[model samples]
Target: MVELKSPAEVEAMARAGAVVAEALTAVAGLAEPGRTTADLDRVAADVLAAHGATSPFLNYHPRWASSPFPAVLCVSVNDAVVHGIPTDEVLADGDLVSVDFGAVLDGWCGDAARSFIVGTPRPADADLIAATDRALFAGITAVKPGNTLGDIGFAIAASVRRDGYGLLADHGGHGIGRTMHEAPHVPNEGRRGKGMKLRPGLVIAIEPMLIGDGTEDYVHDPDGWTLRTASGARAAHSEHTVAVTDDGARLLTL
Candidate 1:
């Protein structure tokens, strides 16, 4: 069933999103050379704890996973596109890190992700990150009542492909409100005018994962998580939870 949030519910979700934003900020600050992925997860955990928010990622037993997720945050590194489990692996200078997180506050949910370069700079990785973020916002710009899901997907895909980047064929966004994931999974690519019509009060996560060098091939790690690029290229991810409204998209996870 499609759950439409009233304006008041939307406001409440924004509160949850604010906590996510704070946690991401804290993670970014602590993500640097000599720090382990576990370090990043620890900071995010502290932020969620301080806010009295619960993590949707921690102990999450999605259908495809062999076991429950073990951490509060997903610390995907370099070629690993998404679902990279946080571990004791130390980060090095110029390594790309993507942190995906979700938080629930006051019975509402918010989810988001951000990719960044740690310590030293890598021009190509930075460019991919910028492009991935642009693709996410492009999808967000298309989130309005009367628009089709295909339109939003096309907007994101066009932006990514324009820069010679590709998206993960399987992973995409989803409806998010009282729960972290819900009906109507949104894709990164689709034909315009197809799919269900978007409506007001419908909130969804708009996330774009850019496969560097425009390849869709990825290797699934033995850990039953972590998707790495087959060619060993880097990847970038960006996301924001948004609410459809009479005006336009109201970003919850800003």
Candidate 2:
């Protein structure tokens, strides 16, 4: 069921979102060649600890997973799309990295992700990251009272298509509140005006994942968590938690 958050609950969620944003910023700053993905996870854990927030990703076991998540950060590199576990793998120059994180503070949750290039960036990789970032904002802009969930997905899909990128249809956004993942699944591609109607107090995470090779097929890693593009094409992801309000969309994870 879709639960509309009260004003007080929304305020709590905003606090959690702030922690998530700060941790992601700090982690992103450390993304460089020669740094290990596990190193990034350590930084994220410190940030959350300093803020008195708990990691929502750590030890999280969804039905599909064989075991609980082992790290605070989802560190996807190169062809990896999402759910990438932190490993000792060293980041290399021109590698495209995507980090997804979630934090819980005062019983509320916030989730977000960002993709960028480490060290010397290739032109195509930079463009791929830029496109996903733009798509995230486009979807966030579509969040407002009376707008359908399809509207959000349509806006995001249009942005990706305009850049000639492929959308990861299997993985998309979701409603977020007391829990990390909630009701009303938000796909990256859909027909406008075809899904649930948006309303005030409805908070959601709008994320867009795009592939460089224009393919949606992906494969799972031996870890039973990491997802990578089957065609070995690089991918990028961007996300932000937003709330639909009477005025407009309020970005909780800004």
lDDT of 2: 0.93
Candidate 2's residue-wise lDDT over 211-252, tens digit each?
998898899999999999999999999999998899979999
lDDT of 1 by residue, 136-233 (tens): 99999998889989999999999998888978767789999988999889999988988989999999998988988888888899999888988888
| TM-score of model 2 vs. true structure | 0.98
Residue 5 shift from truth in candidate 2, angstroms: 0.8
Q: List the residue pairs that clash in candidate 2.
A: none
Candidate 1 lDDT at 115 equals: 97
Off by over 4 Å in 1: none
What lDDT score belongs to each candidate, Candidate 1 first? 0.92, 0.93
Instruction: Name the lDDT of candidate 1.
Output: 0.92
- Backbone steric clashes in candidate 2, count: 0
Q: What does the lDDT read for residue 21 in candidate 2? A: 94
Candidate 1: minimum summed lDDT over ten consecutive residues — where? 162-171
Report per-prediction Cα RMSD to one decimal. 0.8, 0.8
